[model samples]
Target: MDPRCIPEKFFDIKETEVLVTRITGGNVRNALQDIHVADALFDLDELAIIHHTDCGTLTWTEEIIRSKVKSFAGKEHWAEIDKTVYGAVADLDEGVRGDVKWVRAHPLITEKLKKGTQGFVFDIESGKVRKIDV
Candidate 1:
């Protein structure tokens, strides 16, 4: 759902609560690289790693992006970007499960597993959210 489409009253979030999203492949790297998100998860009651079908990030391979980066920013920057894959996945259901596993394995995230984690795939065509088992 476009979260903003619903009024805040529909959910419990308020005051110290927050609703956050990582739109890029729904990668857990955001929490790994960003300390604030890592810290905040401790307070989270649950973490839902959401992804959808036909996401654009799955359009290109890391090698392709690396080659383009080299073409645009010269060899140095491309080398810096190196082997970093942006976690793109062509299979939507597997992708969601993979993200759930990724979050589960992250060091800080593992510490907060008691807070619950799940995967979901939002079907754009059906306007439905289907849960995925990780």
Candidate 2:
């Protein structure tokens, strides 16, 4: 969750309207539950998965992070962490596209929400959000 990537400043929308669920690499796979919760509670009009350039996840591999975790958190914790997807995204555009597709394909996500689900890449350097056509 980068502090620079403020949704309201970039999107020019009121804070109350947007449900910003920030996750590592902006992986929608990790956000399915949040979407489900939002869907159950509110009338969600659209869903946007925004990944950013030069993300922290791009810097490390699963093996490296697992090793670090194993060293710090112990073998049992490492094994559990290894079973999880740490959301290490290699390519920003591909990550956004993949997340969008994953979110859209999920059976639990409502049809209307799936239709409205869009992917975008926030350029940390340029301070711009570019929509990725999936």
Against the true structure, whose lDDT is highest? 2
Task: Estimate TM-scores for all models.
Answer: 0.74, 0.92
Q: Pick out the ten consecutive residues of candidate 1 with the lowest summed lDDT.
A: 1-10
C-alpha lDDT of all candidate models, in order: 0.63, 0.84
lDDT of 2 by residue, 1-134 (tens): 87777777788888587888877788788877788898889968799889888789889888887777778786657669889778887788888888888977888888899899899988888889999999
Clashes of 2: 0
| lDDT for each residue of candidate 1 in 83-125, tens digit (9 for 90 to 100) | 6676656787877777777677766654555348887776656
Model 1: lDDT of residue 67: 70
Model 1 residue 12 CA deviation in Å: 11
Q: What is the overall TM-score of model 2 with all chains considered together?
A: 0.92
Per-residue error for 115 in candidate 1, Å, reads: 5.0
C-alpha RMSD of each candidate structure in angstroms: 4.0, 1.3
